[model samples]
Target: MSHHTLPRPGASVFVYEWPVRLWHWANALFILVLIVSGWFIARPLPTMQIGEATHQFVMGYIRFAHFAAGQLLTVGFLGRIYWAFVGNHHARQAFYLPLWQKSWWRDVLHEARWYAFLESRPGIHVGHNPLAQIAMFLFMVVGMTFMIVTGFALYAEGAQRGSLPDQLFGWLHDALGNSQLMHSLHHLGMYFVVIFMTAHIYLAIREDIMSRQTMVSTMINGYRSFKDDDAA
Candidate 1:
């Protein structure tokens, strides 16, 4: 479950705390690094005979970047989960759905209408709107978990038998019974994360421009400022 605070119109509320903001930007950077390096790892550059073949390690560097980012992302996600327990109410929003509450469902529909242009004004939200909440749950929480599991499983294969990665996540390979299939699935999962990132950026900019409250700056400075005096 999650909670929301209703602030007076034209008031500025501290919504995202420092830890949340740091995780937001750091997660973005880590995902960006992972995506670029993962692509190159899938289709490496042609061999350049400029240096001794033994000395050239272009693919090695790319894989290292990918692996490092993956590990960082995993640790960051775990910390986010821990923060969900100890931080403010908003910090827990991404982890669960309040499906039993009719008000939550109504707000979800209201947000959908606003996004669809059926409504001129959006409802004020101190943290994520219901639609954005659901999106984050799906794309960031569930999607990231899927990627991490599959990613480490793939890494385990390269690490070989009796390695830490193999011990921790290698069962995934046995469960799937085909390494190429795992590769394909992991590649497909990357596209989903990319799609989410693109849509998230577009929506943040759109809301900042059209909504009556802060959007992008809230994530940066942790305060959500209302643009008008009308009460929700």
Candidate 2:
């Protein structure tokens, strides 16, 4: 997922570093928790009359996990943004798009063709391909910011005015005007994240099967080994 196809000969290259690998896994786990708990909160399970009021807190625990995961996601994201500045060039790929470059857009189209089965081979690069870069920029970066802001804004309501969440995210209420709309948008954001995650996993698997380099394993161990000598 990180290294380029060999420019010269056969050997593995280290691409993702420890921080990136660690954050990738942690962020993924946090997102999973958020989605699962968020859904239950939105459409709660049926109440059990068999239990006394003091004996159970099923919904309460679900809401707590949702809130906890949201906080973790926010913190992890902020640290990731910091890594974009301090980490390797590959680490910064998701933070911005190369919209001004014509060749970049051409390669993006090439990637599209590769996915569509129109191209015989996909190109390999040191970092993300152009298409993946743009998708990450828009979906992960921008979409994530949207989710974090709206989520905290909703949390701020429960925290009451003048609390830290309110002070930090209160502007979202001013911009959106209605709490229900914010809730709806946050719910929609979950679907967007799920869609992206599905596509990301599929593309990783497809590339692992078709490409010259290690795809999924590269993220896990921070190195990418080429499977072919053909120039990517």
Candidate 3:
């Protein structure tokens, strides 16, 4: 027990509540849908020569799916933000950095060492560790914001002059001055989300297998259980 520090690991901990878990699974589904539909929109399939353009409504369907997924993502993001305010302290973690706190950095360094294989065990955390928190803030929080803003702005372009999307994000048109630049940035944001998703999945699987604590199943069940009494 002496080795155990923050978030003593002898027993199970309710790390994520139902709201968090529900949002997580829904968000994951929406992201998957968005990625596939977004790809079709950005680089569409070759045109079919059998019929007129009006008969080939594939591109229209793809765009509609993309737009619907984007709306779901926006709604999920806003819901997650609301949860961060009224939910537990764990809920609020990924929203900010503890830059002014020395101990937090020390914990981050400790986690880094663990990742580098310099440490034998990982620090037990009911919520996200400092390093994980930073990743979440950067990729999930910031990345979501970038994707939503740019996506809506682009949507506003097709939505014509006075639609709601245009009304809200019309200023982006004047700021970017050109549609190509906006498209480029939005493409980059999607890539960022893809890369982040890859890393997040790998880490979750690795931690679930290697560490004494639960990882992959934690979000599924909303519980974090430790295999050992002493935490790293």
Candidate 4:
């Protein structure tokens, strides 16, 4: 379709909803807190003795915060997942899989061309950009899977051998060589999430600066104003 055929600014696009926006920013905050606390828990300072009361106190607080943030994260994730099926057409399809290889390739080239400065304007997108869509879906899967596995591993460490968490993580433990391996996988998953978060923030800022659009405000107000002639 020609760019001119696309909806113009003030075309009455109903993009985001308040609940989705709330869930997004809330989840972002929880994830950030979890990442920081998790790092300290994983590697304590050399000067801090592990068996000391002070060390225990710090570790205990970290564990508490991590679990609390985890609960909030799970709630936000489930809400967004539910919205994916029931939300507006744009939200439902924003991060959906590309069914046509031709369209996918076209979008890929368009993205590359834009990035390379070969295109003078951004591409028109009713939903997420092709790359954002793929990254969102992948991150959802990876994040959810990591949370489940890591949660079970942590639970198993405290529960009886025949308890639910222990039983659930047993096969995973065997396959990965033990709980230690599961911990490593969980930690590595954080790196992926960190990378995604960094890129997401950078792109949002870049778009806001270049386009004079409130990329961050969209998450707060559930609306992003764009020129009808704007590429996206």
Candidate 5:
């Protein structure tokens, strides 16, 4: 008698949507290009006229692309924010919350130990690991806030002296001391973004290597191959 093999006990039921994946990679590329171009504009270290003109042109293009990409990223951010409130348990608070403080702390320590090569198993998670969750949240806040403030500042510069944009950011400009200060703050924030981006890519690559699963691919495909018994 022929025997039938049962299907796998459990498999991923949820996957990332096209919009989410597109937003992720597109935003990543846009931010990288923006950062590189922005840095040269902020500080022309090599002091070459040709480089300066090229930098200006590149930065101009980057600013336009950044604005367009920012809009797309904003849409993705808002959609995800809305989803957080109404999505499934896995996609809602569970994904954002730290599980339990003790558990999360333990996991944090486990991560530290794992990085130090002190733990044998080091525990893998399906969703963002605790450290990643926190960093991601911070990036979202800093990135969005910086974009809003700096964007308004730029708009204010082109507005009539007493117009709304001017009025709104005028005090901020004064408090910060000048347009130069605003520019500096905006530029500094990009450094934070770059640091976050570096860590994010490194961790994703590390996880993919260690787990034999594409951590980056999850953002693309939305579905990760989680173990049957893994908790959401």
Candidate 6:
């Protein structure tokens, strides 16, 4: 090993703990359920006379799935926030950015360049890289909050004017002045999540193959293993 380096090849760091791993997979499953059910809710299936009309209740089940998954997602997000405080440093990475740090910003630019194919190698990171930190803060943190708020706000409409959901989230309709507008914004936010997920998967797989360390398995096993210690 080099004098500046602490370990040799195959050295690993315990980055993501069990709680973070569980939450990550659970959150992904919830998002998948929400997306599929929410899609059907947005553009429902054709009216099919299957058995009795009252017994069919197709759309009812879809909406219920969406709502149930949304509730689970909301609870999971809250748990994730709590874990951010008590879990490891890597667990807290998605929630904030160290904007005042010069080196951090420099690494962000470096990673951006690497993503753009302007750089040949990636910067090694035990947790998320600087650019990924920003993306997580924006998409997962801010975007999930937006979806949950608007989703419940829309749900509050169907939940009646005096129910608990309406009492907690009805202000959103008044704040926007038009419930339809709120729906449009919430629908648009789903696309943002889809885009971020696509990019995230591609980058993780690419880095696993081309970069100097493990990527996908890191989340599964909670160990970020380095292939070589050469600096980026």
Q: Which one is best on lDDT?
A: 1
TM-score of 2: 0.94
Off by over 4 Å in 6: 1-7, 229-232
Q: Which of candidates 1 and 4 is the stronger one according to lDDT?
A: 1
**4 or 6, greater by TM-score:** 6
> Between the candidate structures 5 and 6, which one is better when assessed by lDDT?
6
Candidate 2 residue lDDT tens string, 1-232: 3232344445677888888889889989999999999999999988777589898899889999999988988888999999989998888889998778777877888888988899987776656778888888988999999999999999999999999999999879989899999999999999999999999889889888887667898899988776766544
**lDDT-sorted candidate list, best first:** 1, 6, 3, 2, 4, 5
Sequence-dependent TM-score of model 1 = 0.96
For model 6, residues 1-232, the per-residue Cα lDDT tens digits are 1122434567898889998999989999999898888888878888889989868889999999999999999999999999999998789988988988777888888889988899876667778888888889999999999999999999999998999999999999999999989988988988999998998899889889987778899999999898985643
Instruction: Identify the superior model by TM-score, candidate 1 or candidate 6.
Output: 1
Q: Cα lDDT of all candidates, in order?
A: 0.91, 0.86, 0.86, 0.69, 0.63, 0.87
Q: For model 1, how does the per-residue alpha-carbon lDDT over 1-232 read when each residue is reduced to its tens digit?
A: 1235666677898888898999999999999999999998888877778699788888888999999999999999999999999999999988998999998998898889999899887887877888999999999999999999999999998999999999999999999999999999999999999999999999999999898789999999999998876656
| Residue-by-residue lDDT tens digits, candidate 5, 1-232 | 0012212324553445555566567767767666765666666445335565645564456556655654565566677666666654445432354555676787777777877789755455656666676776677555656765685675577565799878886667777778877887788788788888888889888887774234776887787654434332
Residue 40 displacement (Å), model 4: 0.8
After superposing all C-alphas onto the true structure, candidate 1 shows an RMSD in angstroms of 1.8
lDDT of 4 by residue, 130-194 (tens): 66667777775556557656766765776658887688775667677777777787788778889
198, model 4: CA deviation in Å?
0.9
- Predicted model with the maximum TM-score: 1
**Better-scoring candidate (lDDT), 1 or 5:** 1
What value of lDDT does candidate 3 attain over all alpha carbons?
0.86
In model 2, how many backbone clashes occur? 0
